[model samples]
Target: MLATVARPSPESDPFSPPGIALEASALMGLRHLARRGTGATTRGRSGLPGGLVTRRRGRGTEPDDVRPWAEGDDVRHIDRNATARTGTLHVRTHHEERDRAVVLLADFRPSMLFGTRRALRSVAAAEALVLLGWRIAGDGGRVGLCVAGAEPLALPPRGAGRGMAALCQGLARGHAGALAAPLHDDPPLSPILEQARALLPAGGHLVLASALDSPGDDFSERLAALAERISVSLILVSDAFERIAPPGLYPYATPDGRRGTARISGRARPAPEDRLAACARLGLACLRLDTETGPEGFAPLMERLDAVL
Candidate 1:
């Protein structure tokens, strides 16, 4: 069943930025694409179909039985040996495997509430999760999510149903809450990653979306370990301001209403590319997305994900 939560009106929250508002139209477009099953185009190194293929034994590769050819059956599965021996058209069928689980880890911490281009990092992360959830559900797979903020929310993996809708709603709500009440304490991502790892089954898919600027020192090691068991994708969501702050003093206010001016330099501290390289060194498929683009920005990343999955 899908989870339920109280949704606040858009006008109720004055502090919340407009860009952070969830874009229903964009999400619907992605949902339509997912329902059409148009994103599964990658092949794995083992010669198996990539991006949410069944793992359990089924009518996949290994032949289980030879039966009389039926209309609408795939012609590629024709059993030449059986057909020639019986002097009749026959086709081999294998046991179909169960759907795989897809887990999305969204970092909706206070830091993600800031963005300069299109939407806040938190909103971008939520949008990305929505697209992935729809794609996975449309592909006959299950979707799960873990939203990390001051108060983390976890939804177990489930097939296309109320559970998926609940998960999407939970993300949207969580993003708004995070923006309204930014957390002062830094939330550790390692624990969330560990929890998600424990929840996912072997051969499942995992996607982690966050700035990943200061994931604990052992974050890379833990992520590498998890990738060994399942297909993992890391999305680095950022803002244009975070990438390059103009050379001037900019006034900033905290959640507590404390206002201050900070000086900006020609270069952004802790270059985002450095994190990208770090993820690369760990042999991870990482995609860098900024606020300027919408959820449609995920198309290219999904292509790269096809190769990794």
Candidate 2:
């Protein structure tokens, strides 16, 4: 039997940025949108083929990665970064998800801060993560989080516990930090994938949410390499202005108080299309999510999404 998903009301649009910043409550509320159509997307739709799942060791934590410390845990393997950030004792534990762990990577770079719809692209990314994370956790799977930007934050996979709570807190913190960060060249996604590689086990899933403004020249090569080890899903977060900008100069100011004017025209959009084409070539699962449609529209799209699992 198919399930019908509830629609979020505009008056209480959870994706809306509160006080020009994303509220943690809004992000957590996205979990309700995950109840239906999260698991078993498109029958016979395993992201990475069985033969392509590889075993490799990369820099960063291992699959038996970060988790909340318990009475019997060995304190020496504690993840200082995660522990310090979450203000909770965390220890590295070796474990694997029986049904494949999911690590979500969100791009919080300056580019994602721009939006012309319900909320900033970054906030939408956070919503997408929470929805998917809860769905995965609900299915008795572990979920992890990774933020890509000038400074990246990675949380090891956690089941339905404090670890999951920590992951949400991490997302809120990471987004807030990015919103206040100074303008600079956003880092490439390749390195972040390497970090993800280190986090997952032999067969895991990687979900990336980004605007694709600066994927770096080596993105394809790195993506192809990582695809060999993990099932990869790409969410191209965009805005209406990026696709077809209205003919006018729109004034804008970044979070850091930098003012600028954007000259919107009917020029063809290339970056996103190019990136999508590349992912398509690898037979990767790619989904385009526009900030204009907001979570209200995209959450249902996720139900029918065949490739992202």
Candidate 3:
């Protein structure tokens, strides 16, 4: 069962940082940065289905080559200017765009509500969705969003301008819902992933953003199976406090006005390490983003995604 909590206070709290929230308008600032990559979507091409790292390029189309007419060639391809100049039949080749279907899977669970920096983990995930989600839409690729948590929601893929608008609005709606959602037990991600799969085609890509706080034991196995059909990318959202907290006793308050004390030390948690290791072993394109990370951090990641785009 899911309980409903009131909106978090704007004041500072030990577990919940002050002024940490999601704003759809603020995500547009990411647009200028990752201009190259188109979210998580696979280009139509040939490669190993088991998570192939491939950059799909137009087939024999670049440089507008003028080649001698071959047997069974289409008449529409004939280059009249070249044919007249060379006194022989020639064909003109043109470049074409590769199409991809992009979708983002966002995890907004109990753990995502905590942050010791600029914003909550859920907010960061929302930002990532806006960043790549818009890029995909701008590139003429269909964009879809699936929010996973106590109240899961799926927005089917839509193309171009309207698709981009829906994605942004959906982020705002989903983030607000996550804020009010109670701390239900961490749910298995398999069901949400299965739902996302149904929305995409064979070569589609699924971009997942999460803190990996409570991914089930079969998470890695499930990813391996999914790789056999579609491309996958991961965005690891985290906070500096999660890695090492300054030594001190911090006062915290819950949304229900309950108060408590949390002792903090500099020891790091092992969960992030294990999750990162699994991603590495699977050869997934993974990017780490902390609450303090700025747009400059996305340059390299954008380049890689751009190639895949």
Candidate 4:
């Protein structure tokens, strides 16, 4: 069974920087994609079988709660009798909103260790979790996470706080010990992806985070199959620095503790661009993360995605 992992409280997170400013910037860039005069139900394209939930508007009700009106306000829900007795205008405020279930898949293979950045891609994946989860959680949504590698770690869907914590713990672990060993030879990612599919409460969203480092074509096909089942967003985290490293030139240590450098031309892998293009072809919303750029560049990326999702 998938479980939630413990994480430091918001108070203890040293990097718990205020998200409001950053979120506001992302929202600003996303405003163009916003629909104003249209009815609440008409927001964004509908997805999947259930269609979508619509919002009802009234006088005093704000999409994001601005303020209360004194008098002469739209009395869509006013009590005429009460107004006569109280001699004051009264209005009800309603928030027109909907929630999206977001699934986060993190790839924690050993290859993530090869990064020019000190924190490594493994650590960088955790940071991406916070950024992506922040937006979804801000809108009162749920999040599920899956860690892929020789051993896959799964954290079933949970509300914001617990889900984020669980993801962090999953990323911190090197690999699954016992429960994941049995599936090593032919580990089918289908079960986990199906779990993700089940968690998306009709009309929800999905986000898969990975380095695309695993062997074979299983993960790719699994992801394509997932998109057909549900709306998915892919955040592909990769280390560009690794592509430039010369082969055989890596430092190698012998079993006896002796260390030497070998000239290996095949050590380096193909460019991340190819993998990213493949994801785009799969019709998944792709977010390319790099250590050099950090999460600050997420503003524009989310802007483009806001329209699609």
lDDT tens digits, residues 8-100, model 2? 355653223352366666667777777665444322243322212222322233454577878976667778988999999987654322346
Ranking by lDDT: 1, 2, 3, 4
Q: Summarize candidate 1's per-residue lDDT along 194-248 as a digit string, tens digits.
A: 7887778766788898987556678878888877777778888877777666699
Instruction: Score candidate 3 by lDDT.
Output: 0.67
Local lDDT at 198 for model 1 = 70
Instruction: Compare candidates 1 and 4 on lDDT and give the better one.
Output: 1
Model 2 clash pairs are 64-94
**Per-model TM values vs. the true structure:** 0.76, 0.71, 0.76, 0.58
Off by over 4 Å in 1: 1-12, 15-17, 23-30, 33-50, 54-99, 266-269, 303-307
In model 1, how many backbone clashes occur?
6
Residues 1-309, candidate 4: write the lDDT tens digits: 011122335456311222201122332232222222222222343321111233444432343332344666665655565566677754455554455566676654444433454334644555566555544443445766676665566666666555655655565453323222222233445566676677676667776666666534576787788788778877666665555655455554321234556575663455677777888898777777775555555434543454456
Backbone clash numbers for all candidates listed: 6, 1, 0, 5
Model 4 RMSD vs true structure: 11.6
lDDT of 3 by residue, 75-100 (tens): 88889999999999998765533345
Q: How much is 17 displaced in model 3, in angstroms?
A: 9.4
